[model samples]
Target: MTDQRANWTDEKDATWMTEMIYQVVVLGKRANSGFKKESWQAASSKLNIEHRVNYTKVQLKTRNAEMKKQYAQVSQMNSVLESQRSDACG
Candidate 1:
């Protein structure tokens, strides 16, 4: 829950989640793809990889510019972890 991205029962992250859901919905809409059950399931899988595992760095940042601060924090942490992993291996 409190691994890094704060994917727990917190207000900030919960807000982020709500924003993300709306984003995925918007993405589907813009693509002219209806939010069918299967499509949503697939998109959810792709978006939640990092949060669910609290390990993966990949994620779909929302288009909401107001959320850039929160998104930036996550992006920074991911890059740092990636750099550390590279160092440990090489």
Candidate 2:
């Protein structure tokens, strides 16, 4: 088994990147605000242990930004669908 710190990627590892986004973005839902640096540091540690990959703060931040935009679009679509459903049921 390779050491995670030694086997890091060139910031293009999709699997690692996706998990980073899920960790940081999902954690915000469980808290009152943005994730602290310590929170992400812990997340990186846990992810390294579980996935044998390393994700830096900058990578996680980029993923969070990209996911937030996608989340907003999905949220809007869900809202429209709910409204259509409400109309159909009436």
Q: Tens digit of lDDT per residue, candidate 2, span 1-90?
A: 232233434444454455546766776523456766666666556656666656566655565677679889999999999999999999
What global local distance difference test value does model 2 have? 0.61
Per-model TM-score versus the true fold? 0.30, 0.54
Q: Show pairs that collide, candidate 1.
A: none
Q: Candidate 1 regions off by >4 Å? A: 1-66
For every candidate structure, what is the RMSD over all alpha carbons to the true structure, in angstroms? 12.6, 7.8
What's model 2's TM-score?
A: 0.54
Candidate 1 weakest lDDT stretch, 10 residues: 55-64
lDDT (tens digit, per residue) of candidate 1 on 1-90:
223553433543454455446655665433454234443344445445634533222222322333667789999999999999999999
